[model samples]
Target: MKKREVLLLAFAEHPEQREKCWISLSECNFSCKGCAALSKKERSRLISSKDLAYLVFKSSRYFWGKIIKIAVITGDEITLNPESLLSLISNLKDYSVKYFELSTNSFMIDEDLLKELIKLKLPILVKMDLKAYDEKIYKEYSGKSEVRVDESLNLFEGIDRRAKLIIKNWKIRYLTINPILTSK
Candidate 1:
């Protein structure tokens, strides 16, 4: 029954069957309209750094051994847990998993963290979404009126600088922009 056992293992490991090991990394008070990850009326969980780290570490070992890709999405803001996440990245690098995927709202990520990521240069994929260009639009989206559009610009600039160094088996791409369309 070796063949049957192998088939059963493969079936168990299917993408749909594999656990979605999410590490809730932010405590958000604002609930934006278009944020798919958030609840329509209320906020989501605020996970601890240690808990997130453990989830990430388990996800790394589980997927890498099977050559499966770990799709890393955030609860609210990734920049909220930069140090813990940097450590997570180090773990992935140690495992030589070589594939990562992240999607973020680009609210918390800053220039220095961007620089640190550049240094790691892991085969990581990042997708950053900008709520809107103007401070008012962003404020409405994130509850932060003082949102620095210039800082976002600087992050993009850093990405531009580090794009070349990231070419070692990295599937690098930038989904550049923010638009506030009012259909009235």
Candidate 2:
């Protein structure tokens, strides 16, 4: 199979820990109002998943004098490229990364993607950002309807139930963040 590639932004050590790092990705499915990533003038370059894994590993070693223990993959929307994301995770595991935290908008997740993630056999924490529950609020904030997010949530729930039966220890966890919105 051909290896997938993703748009990489940067790799940096976690604020408090040398053994932890953050892998930032560029581009997003949604153009949320006031998003900092959207405001940036610079564009991220596309990189193969294997190359990205190597760069992240090297960065951790260079900065921390050790391998990365935890890698948090965050982006405006990391789930935009499911294949590349899975490849990145698999590559990171090859580097012996112990844990992963993936932050996403939860608008792109589907059954196949979730299954691929579970097959990686790595402990992954999924941070699902729900812009807003109400359709109007969601549209106002993200300039997109909440229908996709709803579908993602439903799909995840169904897959997660089946996954629990297959895996002895299901390591994936979901965190929902609903930002408090103020009317203009």
Candidate 3:
């Protein structure tokens, strides 16, 4: 059976966003604890930026901006494929599309990419998932406590992306500092 895998963020922002674009994981290799989807049963696929765009354009009606507002993609680590991420952002920006929010684990995000990405001035917001607030807890959750929290903290403080270009630059948005929590 040639099964077609389609993924949608069940906890999406708008009812229309889900119907707008069929999203998928980036086949990410980062072992993250803050990934809610990790403990849940969901479906996703590895799709290209072009494919993602077409999907959005096709489902414009469901999209928040009605093809005018930028889409938001939250996940464990979206910066895995730099080219794909850049392409996706570029394509959307070129078309005057704004991807407002993206939740990520900054395991792979670098400074240069951040600079280039901010150039679009597309009102991009990044929600970085740092496993824990403290070094020990962060390491326990994300596995690399040695520098994950410190590094992530540094990125939040040091990375000088403009205000309009950024909405929130924190490593993790909410109070949930530890990445993953299991109800064992």
* Candidate 2 per-residue C-alpha lDDT over 1-184 given as tens digits, one digit per residue, 9 for 90 to 100: 3333233434344344435656667667787888886214343445667987887777667665777888888867788778888888888889989998888988888888988888887888887788886999999999888998888778666443322221233223222212222111
Model 1 scores a TM of 0.55
* Clashes found in each candidate (C-alpha, N, C closer than 3 A): 0, 0, 8
lDDT of 3 by residue, 31-147 (tens): 556555632453355445776565555455343445536556655456666677777767656555655566677766667667767776776777666556687766666666437
* Alpha carbon lDDT at 86, candidate 1: 76
Best prediction by TM-score: 2
The positional error of residue 120 in candidate 2, measured at the CA in angstroms, is 1.1
TM-score of each: 0.55, 0.75, 0.64
Regions more than 4 Å wrong, model 1: 1-26, 29-67, 146-149, 158-184
Clashing pairs in 2: none
Model 2 lDDT, residue 158, Cα: 41
Stretches of candidate 2 above 4 Å error?
1-18, 158-184
Where does model 3 exceed 4 Å of error? 1-6, 9-24, 32-35, 38-42, 62-65, 156-184
Candidate 3's displacement at residue 101, Å, is 1.4
Model 1: lDDT to the true structure = 0.47
